[model samples]
Target: MPFLLNLLLATAAQAPADYTEPDHWLCYPGREDICTEDLSATVIEADGETSVVDFPTARDPEVDCFYVYPTVSGDPSPMSDLEADETEEGVTRTQFAPFRTVCRTFAPVYRQVSIQGLRQLFAGSNKGINPAMAYGDVAAAFAYYLENENDGRPFVLVGHSQGTNILTSLIAREIDGKPVQERMLSAMLIGFNVAVDESGDRGSFKNLAPCKDERETGCVISYVSFKSDAPPPQDARFGRPAEEGTEVLCTNPGDLGGSGPAALDAILPAAAYGTSGRPPAPWVKGQEIKTPFVKVPGLISGSCMKEDGASFLLISVDADPDDPRTDDIGGEVQVAGTILRSWGLHLHDVGLAQGDLIGLVESQAAAYRAKD
Candidate 1:
C-alpha cells in the first residue's frame, strides 16, 4: 500500500506559520518544486492502441489557479503548521500539477486537520481536529496571493474534499459578495457536498451561482462522484444535502448544461488511484505505456443523478470484455475487503475529469480575455 492510502488526516502545532515564507507555498510562478514535474500523458484508445500527449507548462499563462488540496496529511496533531511533506507534494502531483497546461498554478501549505483527527471525526468523536486553524492558514495564503501575486489577473479556485470544505467557507464569507468575486473564473469544488436551499437557490453563496455553461464566469462547479451502480445511501457521508428540504449541488463537468449520460474524458494516472495499490492492468494487452498519466477516453461516462433527495455525479464504467484493453478502474475507499460504497469514486473525482476540466478552464479563459 502507498503512503497516501495509509493516511486519513494531518495537522499542526507550535506558533502559527507565516504565509509570506516561500516554504509555505507548494507551487508559484518561478519556484522549482514538486509542481514543476513532467505532466505528459499516454492516451489509450479502446482498441488497445496508444499515444502520448504532452502538457507543457505555460511560460506566461493567462490565468492563475489557486488550489487547496484535500486532506492527505499524516500528522498526529490536532492542527498542522506550515511544514510541508511528501504527502502534500504527492497529492498536488496527482491533482493540482496537471493544470499547469492552462494556468500558472499557485498552491499553499496551510495548517490542516490531520488524518488522525479525521479518524476521530469519522468515529463521531471530535477529539482533536482544528478546521478553523486550517481555514485561517488558507485564508491568509489567499490574501497574501491577492496582495502580492495577483495583478488584477483572473484566477480559478480549485479544491477537493477537505480542501473543498475550506474553500466553501472562504467563498461564503470572503468572495461571494466581495469585489474580488469579479476576478474569478470559477470555483471547482470536488469530492464534497455543496448545499442549495429548499427554493433551489444558491444556499452556499448568496451572489455566485453554480456554473451551468462552459464559459460561465464567476460561478462554481461542484460535485461528489459516485459509481453509477452504487448510488449514495440515505446516510452517506457525501452527495446528500446537509439539511432537510435542501439539495446538494451536482454539476457534470464533462457535459455541463446538457442532459443524461455524457462521455467522461477521464485522464487518470497510469497507476491506480489509492485503491488497488498498483498500476492499472496494462491498458493494452501486450503494450506498455511509459507516460506518467493515462487518458481512457470512453471507458467511463457520467450523469447528474438526482433522486430520493440525493444528488451526485453518477459514474458508469463501460466495461467491454471483448476489448483488448483493461476495463476496470479503482478509486473506492476499502477497508480489508470491504468497499466503502458510500465514498463511491471519491478518490478519483478530480483525476477522472482532469481533461474535461482543463478544456472548460481554457474556454473560460478565452471568454474572459475576449471581454477584457
Candidate 2:
C-alpha cells in the first residue's frame, strides 16, 4: 500500500495544468531574464474599411508584409507568445488572426502568423528538446503560412535565424519548383542558407540578388554578412554565390527600374527599426578587421556580386553561424542534422547604405499596387 501510494502521488504531481497562471507561477528561477519583454511590437488590423497610410507618398492603403521570427527558447513550448488571447470558450493563438493587422501595411489583405510554437512541433511534445524535429516544425509553419495567409495573394515572407530555415523550406517546397510563382512578391530568408542541401549552390533560383527591374516578377533578397574570408558554401547560408549556372539578377537598389539612389533613398528610411551600429558587445578576442575583402579564418562572406550596375554592398560581421552552444533545445537532434557537427563560424551581413529595408517593404508593395 505504501508503494502504491507513492506512485499515485507521483502521478498527481505530473498532472497537466488546466490553466496557465503566470502571476503566481514561477516560470524561471528568480533573477533570470525571460527575454520576452524585449520584443518591440505593435498590433493593427485593417479590414479594407480603415484608412491606412499609402506607400511612396508614404500613405498607401493597400500594403501587406509578414514577419516571422525564429525559436528563442533553447527548447520548444506551446506557441503562447505569438497569439495569446482569451475567449469565454478558451485561450487560443487564433492561428490566422494576425492577418488583419498584417494586411494593413502591404495589401488590402495582409496576414502574419507566428509559427514560434512550431519549435515544439519540431522538438516533440517534450517542449522541443529535439533539434531536427524543431527544424521540421519550422518548415511546417512556413507551409501553413503560405497555404492559409491572404488566400494566395502576392505577399512577402521574412525570417531570421531558425526562421530563415523555415523560409528556405517554403521557397523550395512552394515557390522554387512549384506553380505558386505568380503569387509571390518576394522572400527575405536572412541569417540562414537557402540551398538544396549543404553541398548545393548558394541559392535555389536563378536571380541571386534582390530583383529591382521593372519587369521582374518575384525575387529573393538574401545575404549573410562576414568581416572576413567566407566559409565553405555548404557551411553558411547567405554570402555565397548562386549556383554556377545561375546569375544574380539585380535591379540596383540605387537605381530601381528607371530611378536612381535619390528616389530609392526617399523611400527607404520610414520602415527603419533598430540601430545599424554593431552590437554593444565586442567580438571575441582577435575577431576585429583592419581591411576590406580579407577573409576571416573559417568565416565565409562571398556573395553574387554584380559587375554591371551599382552592385549591392554586403557588410559582414564575424560570428558562429549555427552555434551549437546556443542550441539549448534539441541538442541531440541538431547533431543528427549535421547542423551541430559543423563549425559554427558564419558571416553576418546586412545591406548597408542602400535603403531602409522597412521602407523597401513599402516600396515593393507600392510596385505591385495596380497588379492586385
Candidate 3:
C-alpha cells in the first residue's frame, strides 16, 4: 500500500506491450546515421579567454560504456518519446560524449518519466507513471548491447538522476551477483543517494560497495554535491541517511576518502552562460551557440561528510575577482518555487568531477584488463 509501490503497480497494469521494444531506441549501434565520434568541447578560462578541446575516439575500444541520461525532457506528457530531441542531444554532448576519450559509448533513449511526471510524483501525485516502464526499456537495451555489441568485454555503467534510478534497479535485478558482474568496471550513479551501512554494505546494493579508492574496480561511486558550507536540508531528495544505522553513500569524486577538499575538473555546456556574462534561462538554446562543452579546470573543490543525519559532497570555489571565468557552474535544483539546497549540486554532479570520474573509469578498465 506504499504510495510509490501502488503507483508502480498502476503503471505496470496500463503499460503498452511495445514498451520494451529496442527499435524505438534513440541511441544504438544499428543507427549508422547518428554521430558518435570527434566529440569536442570549448574551454573557458577565468580570464574570459576561450579555446577548443577535443576528446579521443578509439577505433578498437577495449571497454564499452553503457549510459542512461538524466531527466531532460520538457514534454508535458508523463513519458518522453523515443526520438532524440535537442534536450537529449544537449545532455549527451555535455555528459556522455566526453567519455569517448576512453570507452566506446552506448546510450539508450527510453520512455523516461518526464520533467512533469517527476514534479507530479514529488507533489504526491503518481498519476500512474511507473518508473519500471522506463527501466524495462533500459534493461532491454542493455541486454541487447551485452549480447550483440559487448562481446564479453568489460563495460562501465553510467547514469544520472532518473537514469541513475533506472541503472540502480538494473544492476540490482540483472548485474549484481551474476556472471556479468565480473566484467563490470564501475558504475557512476550520480545525482542520487545510494544508501549503505556504516561498514559500507547492506543498502541499495547487496555486493557492490562504495568505491573506497580511485582505482577500485567493480565498485560504485556515487555522490550529491553541495556548497562546502551548505548542509543538506531535512527534506532533501538526496543524501538522506534514512535508517537509524544507515549512511547515504557519499564518495567524493574529487577526493574518494571522506577527507579534505580537493580541486574539481569542471565541465559544462558553453551555452550555459550568455554573451553578456550572465546566467541565462533554462534551455536558452542560443547561449552556447557554437560550443558543445566548456571546461574550467581548478575552478571548484569538494569533500564528503555527514551533516545533520544527511551525507553529501560539499563544494567550494575561490573565484579570482579579476578573472572572467565566472564562478557559477549552474548545478542547483529548484522545485515548487523553492531551491533544494540539500540535494547538493544536482545540476553539475557529473561535470563537477568529470575528469576524476573519467580517470577512475580508465584506471578500473586497466585493472580489469590486467585481472582478465
Against the true structure, whose lDDT is highest? 1
Q: For model 3, how does the per-residue alpha-carbon lDDT over 1-372 read when each residue is reduced to its tens digit?
A: 123323544556234324245545444543441236445666666555667777766577788888899888777787777776877766776788778778877887777788788778778777657676787778877887887788889899999988887788789889989989988988999987677888766588888988878767888999887776567777777788656788878888877764888887777665541221223232222234366666776667888877888788888876677765556556566554555665667777888888888888888887887785
Write down the worst ten-residue block by lDDT for model 1: 1-10
Clashes of each: 10, 37, 5
Q: How do the residues 265-300 of candidate 2 rate in per-residue lDDT, one tens digit apiece?
A: 211111211221222222123233221111112222
Taken over the whole model, the C-alpha lDDT of each candidate is 0.81, 0.34, 0.73
Clashing pairs in 3: 46-324, 46-325, 225-345, 233-342, 271-288
Which candidate do you rate higher for TM-score, 1 or 2? 1
Poorly placed runs, candidate 2 (over 4 Å): 1-61, 74-132, 139-148, 195-203, 206-210, 227-278, 281-313, 316-355
Best by TM-score: 1
Q: Rank the candidates by lDDT, best first.
A: 1, 3, 2
Candidate 1 colliding pairs? 8-115, 9-114, 9-115, 10-114, 10-115, 11-79, 11-80, 12-79, 12-80, 12-81
**What TM-score number comes out for model 2?**
0.42
TM-score of each: 0.92, 0.42, 0.86
Superposed on all Cα atoms, model 3 deviates from the true structure by an RMSD in Å of: 4.2
Worst 10 residues of 3 by lDDT: 273-282
Q: Please report the TM-score between candidate 1 and the true structure.
A: 0.92
Query: What shift in Å separates residue 332 of candidate 3 from its native position after superposition?
Result: 1.8
